[model samples]
Target: MVEKKFTIESSQGLHARPASVLVNHVTNFEGDVMVHYNGQSINLKSIMGIMGLAISQGAEIKVTAEGEKEEEIMESLEDVLKEQELVKN
Candidate 1:
């Protein structure tokens, strides 16, 4: 398993757009990916689960992935998150 933390930088936080992006991104991986927030962890690939988190600006989240190509998925996720300006530097 691989885990990494990220600070949300989007002014709107993890709203529809960002959440959708995250959901779509996670779907590409063949691993189990979860997002931890507010002491709860949810399936990152589930749009409902992610949107339910209601992540706000500056909120911190930890993403963990286990199973096939976990490392590559994490790295790609990092890149996509950065490109979306959703993950703080």
Candidate 2:
């Protein structure tokens, strides 16, 4: 498993578009992925799960991946955060 902590960069936080990008990235990975905010954790691939997370600006999220493609998924997840997510890790 791999984990990376990233701080939210977008003032509006994830909202809709950025969350979709995150969800889409998670869905593409075959391994298990979980995104943790504060002390709660949710499935990264679920749209509702992500929206329910309601991440806010300056919030810290822990991106984790486990299973066969853990490393790849971790990298992919990081890329999404850096490129699409309103945050940096």
Candidate 3:
């Protein structure tokens, strides 16, 4: 498993658009992906789960991946998150 802690960069937090971008990235991997926020962890590929977090700007989140290609997936996710200005890990 691989995990990276990120501080949410978007002022609006993990809203719809950004959540979709995250979900999209997660779906590309065949491994288990999760986002840890606050004290809870949820499936990264689930839009509803992500939105339910209601993460705010500057909130710290941990993106984790396990199983095959976990490292690559996590790296790609980090890139996209940075590109989207969503989270700085």
Candidate 4:
């Protein structure tokens, strides 16, 4: 498993658009990805699960990937987060 922690930077937090971007990106990978926030963990591929978290700006989140191409998935996710301007610099 590969895990990384990030602080959200978006003013609107992990709202629908960003959540969908994340879910859509990870869906292409053949691995398991999960997001942990506020002591709860949810599948990163599930838009509803992410939305249910109601993550706000500056919230700390931990993402974990396991199985095939876990490391690559982590790197890709980091890239996506950065590209989306969702994480602090």
On the 0 to 100 scale, the lDDT of residue 33 in model 2 is: 94
lDDT of 3 at 73: 94
- For lDDT, the strongest prediction is 4
lDDT of 2 at 10: 90
TM-score of every model versus the real structure:
0.94, 0.90, 0.94, 0.96
For model 3, how does the per-residue alpha-carbon lDDT over 1-89 read when each residue is reduced to its tens digit? 99989898889987899789889878988989999999999999899999999999989999889989998998898888888888654
What lDDT is obtained when candidate 3 is compared to the true structure? 0.89
lDDT of each: 0.90, 0.83, 0.89, 0.94
List where candidate 4 sits over 4 angstroms from the true fold.
Answer: none
What CA RMSD would you report for each candidate? Answer: 1.0, 1.4, 1.2, 0.7
Model 2's lDDT to the true fold? 0.83
Candidate 2 structure quality by residue, lDDT tens digits, 1-89: 89988888899987889888888777876878998886788888888988888888888889888989898888777787788747654
lDDT of 4 by residue, 18-62 (tens): 889999999999989999999999999999999999999999999
Per-model tally of clashing residue pairs:
0, 0, 0, 0
lDDT of 1 at 68: 79
Q: For model 1, how does the per-residue alpha-carbon lDDT over 1-89 read when each residue is reduced to its tens digit?
A: 99999999888998898779878888987979999999999999999999889999999999999987999999989998988889755
**Regions of model 2 farther than 4 Å from truth:** none
